[model samples]
Target chain A: MPILEVKNLNVSFKTIDGVVQAVNNVSFNVEHGEVLGIVGESGSGKSQSVLAIMGLLASNATVTGSIKFLGQELVGVNTKALNKVRGNKLSIIFQDPMTSLNPYLTIKSQMTEVLMLHKGMSKHDAVIESIRMLDFVGIPEAKERIGLYPHEFSGGMRQRVMIAMALLCRPELLIADEPTTALDVTVQAQILKILRDLQTEFKMSIILITHDMGVVANACDRVNVMYAGQLMESGSLDNIFYEPQHPYTQALLASIPSLEHEVERLATIPGEPPNLLALPDGCVFQGRCHKVHQECKGGDVVVQDFGAGRFMKCNLMQNLTNGINQGITSNVVVN
Target chain B: MEKLLEIKDLKVYFELKRSLLGKKRIVYAVDNVSFDVYKGETLGIVGESGCGKSTLARSLVGLNDITDGNVVFLGKDNLAKADSKRWHALRQEIQFIFQDPVASLNPRMTVAEIIAEPLNVYYPKMKDEEVLAKVLDMMHLVGLSDNQINRYPQEFSGGQCQRIGIARALVLNPKLIICDESVSALDVSIKAQIINLLKDLQKKLSLTVIFISHDLSVVKHICDRVLVMYLGNIMELATKEVIYKNHHHPYTQALLAAVPSANPKVEKHKHVKPLEGELPSPLHPPQGCVFSTRCPLADDGCKSARPELRYMDDGALVACFKA
Candidate 1:
């Protein structure tokens, strides 16, 4: 069984304007010791679906369906029950580490708080453990740095502190939401390298939520592409990159400027993501999908199984995969 | 091609007030950087945060004071010596597209009003009707519709707000447009649209652009020449082909290597030489090479003297003792 399975999960928010469906029937599974990437652009439900699973939704938001971890149901659980799981077995690090951390609290206090609360470790022991985790995450002078406030460290160091704090309890699953987006390229590479290494050492599953395809390529073992509150495609990294059936997936691939090749013009998916409050019938991606067809606007779009555990929600998947069916022969799986 | 702008040893330093106990200091935001921008070409300036790429671009428009050196625009005026009156005139030819489109524009101003603001300043003598006509024309050029003319900036999406930004920049009919991470905030699809729009406008108006961005892939796509900077120093300056294909500086190489490619196949096999440590504080940069602290190739000699930006055999100017 997968470590985490989210089935038919939907998230909607209540606003003055109307009820906005932020995540629509999104489902995916993360296996043990795997890196899963939830990829999408802004306004996509990539973050919302995970937030729903973590029980971190806004007060006005409503979440439905099932989120299971280790054969245990997590959906609709009370705050106390969810808290036992969060920051213990499952932890999350947000986009901006600076905001995620309290500006007034010292790193030692913040990190030791998690260890004491979760592990029931003594204050003295917790401090030592916190420094060890900080050292593991490559923070130089971890013992000395732990006494300083969040503002004392640089952007990259602050992220490391966040990572160290998240791993203090040694959680089995870590949901890093755009962890490196705020960082520079060199720092991004360093942070990603550390994350990859720590994942192996801790044997943890990670759900990396990001909009950058390059990040998805670098870190994810399995990939899920979301658009306007819907899971467009889910597959192994190799399958998604090599044999994408959904037009949204294909368009996103073409949209990113390639480092390996230069093109005169980039292939852009025209039109904006659908407004959640007033999403159209049939397909949510119909407006932007380059290969959109008449059937896409007719009725409900169906998710098609392409075998190899790959699934995609698209009306034209049949014709789209006619040329390349089944087995991916030339798969170069990214680390 | 004509040399539109020649920057000679451009420096922008901010003086810090003396503390009660400590001595006064200066932060070299942009330190003795020099480069030339050709007419009808897009020159890309790429660096990480605090590298002074934005400061360099801002100095061209007199947004920041130049502590030293000269900016020769159109091979005539030395902008470093230009007073406020001369700067007011220089602003007519050189316009800036800021990083955040939504914040850069006034939230209360309608799209039409925002676009017409530049025209009001540059062409103050023009009639109101003519200004409206020019604003509408710019709106059409930048892909905004007539209906959005009365809509405020808050109502538009990020891409549309950026379109409004471009319209404002173009309304002046400037010879040069400095886009400072203009498309960095937009989604990929929207970024593509903005990039294509900029390309089209550059050709149509024969406009020279100094595009500043951290993303190298975007820089590679839009720029004819590229300048790499670190610690307010120009590390390398070359044509796109030379910079991307034949970079000599280790800092530049590390930057290119760090960019995670979208291609899974390429990423799987690609070797990323992760740069050691973080970018040192600009206020206390290494005594010798700016990059020597983190450079894999740095030796004792690299820690003794800063390398000058000198021309190489490959027609590229690189700042490294080994290069």
Candidate 2:
């Protein structure tokens, strides 16, 4: 069985005005020890979908879905049982380090709290284990800095501290939300190296949420494209990069000013994302899509299996057009 | 090309009380940094956090008063006293686009109100109908619709909100616009959209833009000339071709390395070797070369003596001992 299976996940946020459908019938899976990347623009709801699966959605958000984690339904799991699965089985590393970390508490206090709560370790053992976790994420002289507050460390180092705190319970699955967004490139490389190495050693599945194609290409095995809270496309990394089926995904790839790309002008997706509250009758990408058709108004994800477990979703009437674009633009766009 | 804006050894300092006896503590935010913005060109000022990119920007725009040296805008020097009329004129000509859209724009105000605020202040005598018409034209230019005009800042997404910010800056038709990490807060796809919009606006308006950002890739995408700063000093300034292709300063190269390659072949490969240590605090900077503490190429000479930015070309300038 897959490590985690999310089936037809539908999520909505209850604001004062009305229910905003954030995630609409999205489904994906992560195999054991696999790194799945969910890439999209801002307000894509990639973060919300995964947060729903982890049973960590915000207080007002209403979720309707079947999330199976190691064969257990996570949607309706009790708070007590969910708490057991949260820190030990599944964990999250949020984007902003400054807000995520407590300014007054030391790394030792934070890491040890998770250890004692989830792993049920003694104070003495927790201290030792916390230092080990710190060292693993590359906080140099973990013994000395463990007592330092979040404000004492640099931004990159503080993120490492956050990672150390998350991994204290030896989670089976890690949900890293824009883990490298605020970091510089070299520091990003260091973080990715650390996460990849630790994932192999611990044999944990990972779902990285980011809007950066570079990050997705570097880290993930599978890529899921989300837009306006809908899964526009899902496929292997090779399929997503080499032959993007969806118009939105193709436009996203075109917009990146890459080293491989030689162009007079980049093609930006023409319009803004549809507001989650006022979605159109057609596909979510229809407004910005170049090859949008009447068939796309039906909201059917035309999926084609390219064998070997790879899948693609495109407009049924416009597959050949995107294919021709793939061949023509691929040469100029890819190095 | 005639330089539109020139900074001659600009130094901005803040003095604070340190002890009971009122000892002074000086924060050298922009220490002897100098550069020029030319006609219809984009100059990128890049540095990591606390390296004083925004400080230099504030100093140039006359928001933060300068402590030393002159910032020559057009033909006049503003370091000394300039009349209120000239100050107001400078305000109209030189504009700033802030980093965070959510923070920069007023949440309570609609997009039309936010964009019109500056126009009302700067063009007090202008007709109200004309201003609203121009606002709609600008909205169309930045890819926003007329329906979004009445919507509040919170109603739009980050990208849409930033478009409103850009439209506000462009409503005045300024010659020089200071974008201080404008795209840094956006996603890559959205970043490209904003960048493309800015580029389009720049060309159409013949804008002389000073784009400040730490990301080299973003600078590479938009700028004509790039100035690499470290610890409040100009380490290097060259054309994008020369800087990205063959950067001379160790700090500039190191900064370039820190931007993760969008390509697959090269991961986070250090360009000039790993910068040895963190950036020294601006409050108490190191002696001589500011980057010596974190420079792999530092020598004994680097620790003891400072290097001035000598002209490599008439255009390119580098301030490294080894360079």
Using Cα atoms, each model's DockQ against the true complex is 0.82, 0.43
DockQ for candidate 2, C-alpha atoms: 0.43
At residue B316, candidate 2 shows an lDDT of: 79
Which residues of candidate 1, in runs, are more than 4 Å off?
A319-323, A326-335
Off by over 4 Å in 2: A259-262, A317-335, B16-23, B80-85, B107-119, B128-155, B266-277, B313-315
lDDT at position A27, candidate 1: 78
RMSD of each: 3.0, 3.4
Q: Report clash pairs, candidate 2.
A: none
What fraction of the reference interface contacts is present in each model, in order?
Answer: 0.71, 0.32
The CA lDDT at A208 in model 2 is: 95
Candidate 2 CAPRI grade: acceptable
* Strongest candidate by DockQ: 1
Candidate 2 lDDT tens digits, B1-323: 98888788789888877968787788888898777889899999988778888989987777777888878888675643555677777777888898998889989998989889888997788898998998999899888989888999887778888899898888888888999999888876677778888888899889999999877767787889999888789899999888888889988777666555544445423233334336677888988899998788888999999999988854579998898
